[model samples]
Target: MILEPKMIEEVQAAVQEAKCLGVRGQGTKPALAMAWGETAVLSTRHLSGILAYEPNEYTFTAYAGTAVSEVITTLAQNNQYLPFDPLWVEAGATLGGTVAANASGSGRYRYGGVRDFILGVSFVDGSGQLVRGGGKVVKNSAGFDIPKFMVGSLGRYGILVELTFKVFPKPRSYVTLQLQYASLHAALFAMFKLAVMPFEMDVLDLAPELAGKATLIIRLGGLPEALPGRVERMRGFLQEQTEVETAVLLENEADITYWQAQNRFDWAFAASQLVKIPVTPKQIPTLDKHLTNTLRRYSAGGNVAWVAADDMTALQTTLTELNLAGLQFTGHTDDPYLGSRKGRRFAQRIKKALDPNAVFSTND
Candidate 1:
């Protein structure tokens, strides 16, 4: 059964009556939502709209079910945007779903992720109570940081009813440089070199190419007139300091479309499973060796891995062998978690405190 709640009181009542409930927004991630088994799915579709927006203060509050696309459009009109670049917006991802999934895109490389921008949240707890945390303003720092805790919580703690986020002025212009390297080692070396420099890169991503080669994708955002010089300087730096084979610069509509494709996961459309794994650059070389047949991309300077694979069992085995954990977003599975588990003990403690009745899914 599915329940669509249109208000806080409705959400509270739904939680109060349901034996076990799974929360969702638009159902963009069906695998993760369905992991709750036979529970009634609580859809936040009807509970939508922006509540408040303060352009001067750079903050906005909206219903949890508010479409991320709407938020982006509204912010664009104000010459501002969410710097973390919430992902899956074009795919009908809701503000609440993005927060619950912690789905930030490549832009997170500069400003940080979903947890960094979220200032406040209102949710219905397991006991059918409405709870508010943090503040609508940005200077808030008085509570238990329940807002941050709700990030990536996947409704295990509470069902987010509304959220407030801090945004930044949108950059006037943007450019992307795609640098090719003969090998992953060379590309990684270039990434390390670029990381230390003050390039102020807005995005740094890596992807493997044929024959063990790799491509380093970098994005820069700033004044329109100043972008050309900056792009040349970046190209010159890589050419002189690293073993970069070639560089392709994208601008205007091309640059916009490229990133949109990435944010939409267009390249991984053929894969049956899409999983996100937190990783460091140092661990990527070893991890890459095992993902021979999978499609993967490294974002945030190799701080995160998005993997698309057809063989779920094989991927799970590889992650387990490497002592890594992954959260699946697509495909079927009894559990969305794969490989070695982490933070279970602490998560369980929080779950007990927030949802003692076990009304919500136990997964994090």
Candidate 2:
């Protein structure tokens, strides 16, 4: 693992000499979409520090290696936050890894993902040059929007060394409401129906284990006065439609823990294949039905499904049959990644320009 020093020249040399740049924040996400064979990992831990913060402008810039926790803390102190709450608690995940992996917790359902929060970024391209994209402010649209393209690039594009995000003010109060359903089908249906209403959700997830049955966890973030009534109205409508016998009101911390587990691939699906499938909400049902025994968790918020299993070939075939693609998270030695959009010609172009030598992980 490469721990980058603060000096720009040091970063340049490391990128120049490395055969493949495995950019990692805390090595928390190494298993998913990883590259082996003569690859050198870049740990941004040492390059860490907050470069700038302008709360008034809702903007903050930090080194890529800066811990996601640190940034959230700073934002909180200012009564603000990275609205797209990133999920890297135990892994010491960095800002770069969050963007590289495009990993965000359930809170993403409210506003958007890292793609929506990222205003700009700084990086050392394959050529080992220090470069910057997007302005430091919130409203600037000066040149091409390269930062977003790098948001979910998974390090195949360029090595992200620093980032700038347009932060959001913290909510006054947050409340979580969970509804127990007899099955995932029912819970998912309730979630999709609620998504269209005039509601603000910090998180929405389904937990079938402890519930002894499937359940959908819906979290609301807003002012204190508004929470009780909002929860009541939502509850009435949900109960009228589904077989929800229980509506558990979880405290703030409890809600956070539930969503983080999903974001970090926790709760012990260890050493198995963790595949991500992206499709429209309607397609989720069809795809979920195809998984013979692979336990599934569909992030109805992001239209991303997490499939866990010990088999890889079957996962690939199933995904292909459904006309979907996924990034291989964890699995056997030679598991195949479902890969990018078949016609992502523009993605290839961006990857070429940022990593002309294809110095990062090459799924191709």
Candidate 3:
């Protein structure tokens, strides 16, 4: 059965009653929601709306169940946005769900991810007790830092009721430069070179092209008058200093549409399974070798890989061989986690303390 709580008290009551509860928002992540097994589902959809938004103060508090799309629209009106670029907003991803999953988009290359922007959170613990952490301001430095701890917690500790996040002023203009490389090795070499150079990139991504080639996508955001010159300089530098086969400049609508599709994961729309693996650029060459058949994109300068695969078993085996782990967001499986599991001992200790009664399903 599913319970939709419209108020804090209602959420608490639902939590207290369920022996095994699965917390969810709008069910944007079906695979994750399915991992809960036969447990009772607690939907936060009804408990939605912005509690407070202070554009001048650069922070906003909203019910966890509130849609991220709503927050983005509201922030856009004020010329401010969440720097982490919360993902799945176009598919009705909720603020709390994004926090629970720790999902961020390409822009995370600049300002950081969900954990970096979250200021505070209010949640109902496993025992149905209301708990609060952090504050609704940017300079908060007190308590157990529970807000950060809750990130990627996946509702194992508590059900988030409200969330607060800091925002930044939206950039006035943007451009993307697509640099082509003859091979993955060459592309990664260029990325390492670009990393040390003095360029403020808003997004850095790499994708495979035909014939074993690769494309390096770089986004620059700033004043409109200054963008053309910046793009030219960056493009010229890549042409002269790196093994770039071609450099194409994308601007205005083309730039916007390209990034929007990327952030939305449109390329993975047809895949049966979608998994996120944390990785470094140094490991990409080896990982790429094993994922030739999979649709993959390396984002945030190769700090993360989003893989869309048809063969979960083979993919899991490959990740295990590499000593890497992946968090599955789509497709069917007995477990949402693939390959090597990390930090289980520490997580178990925290889970015991927060949800001693095991009211929240851990899917372990």
The prediction achieving the highest lDDT against the true structure is 1
What's the residue-level lDDT of 30 in candidate 2?
53
Greater TM-score among 2 and 3 belongs to: 3
Which sections of candidate 3 miss by over 4 Å?
A: 136-143
lDDT per residue as tens, model 3, 1-364: 8889999999999888878898889888777777356468998988999999999999999999999999999999999988898888888999999999998999999889999999999999999999888884433355468889999998999999999999999998899999899998888988888888888999888988537899999999999999988888887888887878877888999998987888778888565688999999999999999888678899999999999988888989999999999999877766789988889898999899889998998865
> What would the TM-scores of all predictions be?
0.97, 0.89, 0.96
Local error of candidate 3 at residue 112 (angstroms):
0.3
Clashing pairs in 1: none
Order candidates by TM-score, high to low.
1, 3, 2
| Per-residue lDDT over 1-364 for candidate 1, one digit per residue giving the tens place of the 0 to 100 score | 8899888899999999988888899888877778366468899978999999999999999999999999999999999999998887888899999999888899999989999999999999999999888884433456468889889898899999999999999998999999999988899999999999999999999988647889999999999999999988888888889987878999999999999999988879554789999999999999998875678889999999999888888989998999999999887777888898988898999888889989997655
Better of 2 and 3 by lDDT: 3
What clash count goes with each model? Answer: 0, 1, 0
Question: Which of the predicted structures, 1 or 2, would earn the higher TM-score when compared with the native?
Answer: 1
Candidate 1: stretches off by over 4 Å:
136-143
The C-alpha stretches of model 2 lying farther than 4 A from their native spots are: 1-3, 136-143, 207-213, 260-262, 300-302, 330-336, 339-344
